[model samples]
Target: MDGLGNYLAPDHRRCDDYFSAAEAAALQGEWEAAEAQFNHFLAGMQHHFAKEETVLFPAFEQSTHLTGGPTEVMRMEHAQMRGLFQDMQQALASRDANAYAGAAETLLILMQQHNLKEEQMLYRMCDQMLVRESAELIARMNAIAQ
Candidate 1:
């Protein structure tokens, strides 16, 4: 009912939870569990990115006609996170705890910053500017598989 922030903020938390679980497992040298948890985290993150890039950003751009604004910044940040994801994936494949930990630390910082921006600014803008379309927009986001 609150719109974009209501929908996406919880998703950020869900993905962070998976990320934390994966990191904890890796730190404990639980490779099998770490892999499973990391896979979940990765999939969740990819889905979130897809929804924003495909659905939310486009809608926001069309409504606001602000193509070169916060959404653009968020897109770039997404690319950075994807690169980190690749690093984490490679470390996970090798079961390298040290490498994974290093990547995870960077990723955690990136994600926290990114989520704060979305929750505090971008999502609020979407909620206000796209009020009429909020329900359908949120429904579309929800339909994305985690």
Candidate 2:
């Protein structure tokens, strides 16, 4: 890949694809399909977050010494997204499509906003500031388990 954005930006789209598939299945009342897709989506997202929190963000922080800047905001947003995941899980477990839809809508909005910021700002920052370490950082990110 080109670098940080090249590796991680596609992941954002992959996760979005999973998220959309799961939501579509859920909205259609296809509980089994929804469960399968949601599980996949959840696992992917958790892995993505771990890669960022453990590998990418730490590298950025060390390189830039800006620990409490964008990374901190991203961590908070990750927490918020995790909470939404919980709500979605509970709604799925209960077979409450309406509840799931509500949560999914909120999640979709949040995710779009969050992904935009990361793609436009954070990943660009990483690409610029960590150019020398890009390959190592990408390898570490790729090594993270889903």
Candidate 3:
């Protein structure tokens, strides 16, 4: 489960699928299913974030001694993403279809673009510079995720 080659791409697809499912469910007025799928999507996101934040990002930081790298930006963006997710959760809780749909659309864009950047640039950096230090932990995290 290489980060750039397989793991990250697959994770991107999983997120895409969940977001699609959630959107469809919401469009169909299946509020419960939509809510469930959204929750599941959030959980999946958190899991991947954990691997990056705890293992991959730390590996980069330790190797380069540079804190304000892509990972730092990613983490800050994650906090913003979480705020959006929280709003989505509240919308879901209230069964506000309009709000939920809007938030979901925004989140879909945010996550997709974020994943693209990491896969294209940041993950490549990890592979090039920190692969030896990061390889084992990243693989282990991916394994546990699967």
On lDDT, the candidate that comes out on top is 2
Model 3 residue runs over 4 Å out of place are 1-5, 142-146
How displaced is residue 46 in candidate 3, in Å? 0.6
TM-score (all chains, Cα) for each model:
0.95, 0.97, 0.89
The residue pairs that clash in candidate 1, if any, are none
Q: In candidate 3, residue 98 scores what lDDT? A: 91
Residue-by-residue lDDT tens digits, candidate 3, 18-91: 87888788778898998889878888888877777877788778878889877899998788789988988888
Give the Cα error of residue 122 in candidate 1, in Å: 0.2
In TM-score terms, candidate 3 sits at 0.89
**Global Cα lDDT for candidate 3:** 0.79
Taking the tens digit of each residue's C-alpha lDDT, what string does model 1 give over 1-146? 57788877888988988999999999898989999999999898999998899889999999999999999999999999999999998998898999999999999999899999998899999998999998898789778776
Error of 3 at 78 (Å): 0.9
The TM-score measured for candidate 2 stands at 0.97
